[model samples]
Target: MSTACPSNPRKRDRESSPAEQWRNLARTVPATLMHIGTSSSVKAIRSTKNAKSAMKAAKRSGDLSPAGKPDASGSSWPPEAVELLQQARDDVSIGLKALRDTRDAIVVEFFDAWKVLNQNR
Candidate 1:
């Protein structure tokens, strides 16, 4: 005699193999890494804040050498480079917010996947 599959949609979903469940959950890894990258970039920017401030202060104080050239005695980012760093910091802050929102999304997705995979057991 031929056997029949379960008619319940939920039962069919729960029947997915463990490897399939793992592959489903693995999709969250890239999002997690993006979050980590944002956090690291923010932290790095914060750590350099003092140096950036010092450079700004020096520039404002006319520490430039004759002919309006930067003093060779110390190193600092060029104006364009500084602007780019500022842009990066702004972008990282926005990315961090987005990643924070996605954090909850990933967790809920993982829990749902786990529930589905374990429901049949």
Candidate 2:
């Protein structure tokens, strides 16, 4: 004779598997990157105050060398940082395009539905 308990087995106590963890992280990274990019862009724009103010500051502080040149003496911001900023800008642009497309599609769908309903009536 064989005996088996009817109760369900206890939930497995385990961390996510490596692949699962990686997938989860991958999903989160884009959102985090987008947030960081948007924040940096906002900061950059805000820091400029007005274009005139920024130009004046740069000119007065000698950040711009003679003849309105950017000085090479300062450390270059990391290439990765610049790349990320560009990616963020592109992502935002794509997102806006997607939103517009979706809105247009929905409007068309709604109008089509209304036409169908009117025809049926």
Candidate 3:
């Protein structure tokens, strides 16, 4: 199999140089990687909607017993512990956002380098 670029959009009507063909192929790398990274980073974060629904269902089914927490649960958990858990959850959410931002920044860096390399051409 040929290791050359897969397709040349400019080849339909006119012949294109190898360098141009390779540059076109090179342009796709950063964009594809960024999309993959974004999807992966988004998948790392979990939404509380599902948990809220489950908690509601459990409360209706008499599976949860009240202790004193009315914030998100009816379970017999100490208020201090619940507060700590909520704080941890918030931290995790912020960390996940940072992860996504970092991934996007890496992609932006790559794109910037690409632009610099192709600038004088």
Q: Give the per-residue lDDT of model 1 (tens digit) for 1-121.
A: 2233677545333455667656866776556656655665566556456446644654654444344655454345356544544655565565565556556666765677668668768
**TM-score between candidate 1 and the true structure:** 0.34
TM accuracy, model 3: 0.40
Per-residue accuracy of model 2 over 25-98 as CA lDDT, tens digit each? 56765565566556555645544344334345444544333445433543343344344444555555555555
Q: What is the TM-score of each candidate against the true structure?
A: 0.34, 0.37, 0.40
Q: What is the C-alpha RMSD of each candidate to the true structure, in Å?
A: 9.7, 16.3, 7.8
Q: Any residue pairs clashing in model 1, and if so which?
A: none
Candidate 3: residue 34 Cα off by (Å) = 17
Please provide, for model 3 over 1-121, each residue's C-alpha lDDT reduced to its tens digit, 9 standing for 90 to 100. 1343448655445455656655865786667667767665554543344334444554444433353334454356544445545655665666577577768767776776677557658
| Candidate 2: C-alpha lDDT | 0.50
Task: Write down the worst ten-residue block by lDDT for model 3.
Answer: 61-70
User: How many collisions between residues are there in candidate 2?
Assistant: 0
Write the number of the candidate with greater lDDT, choosing between 1 and 2.
1
Models sorted by TM-score, best on top:
3, 2, 1
